[model samples]
Target: MIDTLWLIGIGTGSPAHVTMEGMQAIREASVILVPHKGAGKDDLASLRHGIIAAAGSTARIVPFDYPIRDPALPYLERVERWHDEIAARWQTALADVGVSGPVALLVWGDPSLYDSTIRIARRLTPQPTLRVVPGITAVQALTAAHGIPLNDVNGPIQITTGRRLRDHGWPIGATRLVVMLDGEASFQHLDEPDLLIWWGAYLGMPEQVLDHGPLADVATRIVAARQAARAQHGWIMDTYLLGRPQDAH
Candidate 1:
């Protein structure tokens, strides 16, 4: 039986991005669960390991293979099924460790963002007390890396996924938008001539890449850079902002 479950956000790829509270949670937990996303994505697992080591935590590190979502299914359905499987895996991992002490899982970014760990954790049987340690979000990391502000003065910003941006176009009422979980560079789908984009890949890491300009002028370069980065690293985590400058008004 689990006593407490800590969902600690470790921030984007950089170990230094981990917040003090997150590190303390890592050091205090009796067992820390880390997900292995297979060969091409081992860097993620390695990053988690490095964080644990850097914290000087002696907690037992449990590694479990992450479930792959079936692309054949629709997006929502596929993600729902994948989360069920992941919750089951978490339960099994906990059973294997056979620990009743506080358990922790390191999340890539703030759990409240697009991440689903909180949703999956809710599915666990005999629910344990949940504690969340907030960490740096990709939007923050991306903006900071580019040395820019997230939104124009006195304007609202919409945050959404690549799929939504592709399927629904930009939402109304918000001039500024930040897109995440976009593997297809959804910005290309928009024909907004005045749109400006600030894109970053591998933010906060050694191989970080950033580009900004009118969408029409730089979209091709962004796509090529994204493709080359994925080819070189086998995977990529990226986020971007697309909107017109305040002066355009």
Candidate 2:
């Protein structure tokens, strides 16, 4: 009965991203699950494999194909269906192996942030005991890569998607924002004056790319760089911090 599941954060791509605690979780598990999101994105899975290998984990590695969301469904519905499908796959994979001890999943970042792994884990037949080993988050990596503080003096930080920032406008009273899951490069449409932008793609990876300046000055450059990087790598995971010009030194 695989009732215990270790949700270990593997951090962004770098092998050094996984924490010592995360490494220990990998070593203690009887099996580890890795998800593959189809073709042209082999690097994502390979990165996870590399992290596991670097951790010196001897646990059985089980790879599963992630389900694509149905295009016809509404946005929320599509995500719900996709999550259910993922939960089923997790169950089948572990049961098929007859895993007896603690099972683990190498989450890309801290399981608590913008990740549905914990939600999916709860969908299991009889929910497994989840112990999360936190690792560095993309937000942390983005700020570090750019050598900037996440928030201004006595300012509140808002973390939202590029879509929300596009649809609803800048969050009211937010002095800074860390936008994620923004494939559409939504910042190009913002006409706010004195808005500074700091963007990075493939954070913590060898092929990392970064750009920062007044949004008006560097929007086009960031767009071009994002396109070129995605074309070369077949995938991109990026985040950006937006703040007023006064926020920067």
Candidate 3:
């Protein structure tokens, strides 16, 4: 039985994103839970395996098929139900392993971001001591890969999802928004012509694609490219930053 649940951020499918502290935690863990998202997303699991392999840890790996969320229901309700299923899955995975030592899970990107693994961990009947090892986030990965700053100096950045951006207008207060998990290029809906966008798909991977320009000019291309990439690969992970240049207005 694991006495400690260590949620280690492995970054966005890259071993290089693992910090030394994360590596140390993996080495100390007796068992690791790796979630497989079926055939299309096997690489996601493979990346987690690679991180453990690189860390030189002999901890036993327990692989589980992630339960897909029901999209028919309201979004928040669906996520809540999905989280319940995932927590059940986690309990089942840890059942036979014995919880005497540390248990680790490699979360994509940082756990504090959009990940629900931390929330799931809290649902355990006998909650274990939790430790978080921060890794590169999609925001950081995209900005660094493109050599762009996340926000203007002395300015705040709002991090939101594609769904929210599409349903709600641009968020109030912050001019810069980092959008993630957008299935469609929702920026095309923005009526403002002055808005500029820096978009990236499969960032940090060899298949990475980047586009930047006035939203009106590149919106069509971005949507087309996103569709093509999704069809080519079984799955896709993308993020974008929207902002107006400081000198523009």
The alpha-carbon RMSD values of the candidates against the true structure, listed in the order shown, are 1.4, 1.0, 1.7
- Model 3 vs truth, CA RMSD: 1.7
TM-score of 2: 0.98
User: By the lDDT metric, which is better: model 2 or model 3?
Assistant: 2
Worst 10 residues of 1 by lDDT: 240-249
Question: Which pairs of residues clash in candidate 3, taking residues 3 or more apart in a chain or in different chains?
Answer: 1-98, 1-99, 1-100, 2-99
Which candidate has the top score in lDDT? 1
Residue lDDT tens for model 3, 1-249: 457889999887668888999999999998999998887888788778888999999899998879999989998899999998988888888788766678899988999998888999888878789998898898998888778888787778899998998999798776799999888778888875488888888877777888887887888998888888888888889999899867123
What candidate 3 gets wrong by more than 4 Å, as runs, is 247-249
Using TM-score as the measure, the top candidate is 2
Q: Which run of 10 residues does model 3 get worst, by summed lDDT?
A: 240-249
Compose the digit string of candidate 1's lDDT tens values, residues 107-224: 9989999999999999888888999999999999998997887877777889999989998987877688999999999999897668889999988888889999899999999999
lDDT computed for candidate 2:
0.89
Quick one: how many clashes does candidate 2 have?
Answer: 0
Better of 2 and 3 by TM-score: 2
Model 1 compared with the native: what TM-score?
0.96
Winner on lDDT between 1 and 3 is 1
List the global CA lDDT of all models.
0.89, 0.89, 0.85
Ranking by lDDT: 1, 2, 3
Score every model by TM-score.
0.96, 0.98, 0.95
The residue ranges of model 2 lying beyond 4 angstroms of the native Cα positions read: none
